[model samples]
Target: MATDIPSPDARPARSGRRSGDSTTRTDILVAARTLFGENGFTKTSMRAIAAEAGVDVALVSYHFGNKRGLFSAVMEIPGDPVLRVTTAAAGPREDLGRRLITTFITLWENDDTGVALRAMLRSAVNDEGAATAFGDFASGAMMPAIATTTGLSTETVRAIGSCIFGLAVMRYLIRAEAFTALTTDDVIEQFGPRLQAIVDADT
Candidate 1:
């Protein structure tokens, strides 16, 4: 048998995959943070993050659930939008809207989580990629979770999601004087019924 020989310009083939170990998680986070900082959340793809981390693309999803989840992890968002929204839906149907509004206010008013969330919203307003990513997260994950928990139609859940998203922009991001002047209770009182109407109408 002839011995195999490498060509002069050939190099050793290498696999970028890292062993699935405790450090793998940390590696992905580090990679994600670096890429996110360089390219921003909208520009950074899950595959790019995985390649940067030398891990499989599926590994990123395995740890963070999806692109938005990975972004939340990299940004150190206190709690995820999905978790917060789903938690709000855990109560009685009549109270769902109020609970949702309350949860949104509590989260957006927090020092740490609020800052990160504000950044995300501002980015979406200014960047097309970020807007697309935000829309995907809201429609793909957030609305589905709410629809499942509340037994609402997709259309109804989407309407509620849209309402909540607009709430964030007006009250926090835009700082519309009218909206910002209202106290949290005022917001819940006024907006809760709007969401309730959507849910109630879905019959």
Candidate 2:
């Protein structure tokens, strides 16, 4: 069954300035991130963000032009994942796994990236459009490139992608004790080789 997708304009209450002023813009982004992370993108609204940031609704339009733009800003992710993956995947196939894992971890460890990811995940759960956005990013950016570089099948590549998503969910969102507390090095040491195996699998 098709679900009702929440518009960005339908969000809950927020705590700050209105949207257009420099301070308000910054405030809106910050509030939007928190709400988006907590409630999923579909459920978050420009009105709520404006309220949270103490700004007017029109200012949101003036500053971001729309909810998607606000989402992009909150995510803080660079160009589309496809471009990012293509650029990052430009080395020897054998080194692709390690490089990918390393780069991904580094990006996630950053506070901004972590918050962005949280928002993305939340959005994915509530909105098909958001899920499509994420899928395009994963497929166009990461999976195909990994498959091409490492000669893995599409399914295998997707499995590796699943692993990455699972890891993030367990470690960050769920805060699984061991996964959460592990030092970055500990995680890489344990999961890196497994990810490589998936990428280089015989299937």
Highest lDDT: give the candidate number.
1
Worst 10 residues of 2 by lDDT: 1-10
TM-score of each: 0.73, 0.57
lDDT per residue (tens digit) for residues 62-91 in model 1 = 998877678677655666777878888987
**Candidate 2: tens digits of C-alpha lDDT, residues 85-168:** 556667776666677677667767877666776766777667665565455545544577667766678898788788878888
Global fold similarity of model 1 (TM-score)? 0.73
> Candidate 1: where are CA atoms >4 Å away?
1-49, 56-68, 74-76
Please report the candidate that would top TM-score against the real structure: 1
- lDDT of all predictions: 0.75, 0.67
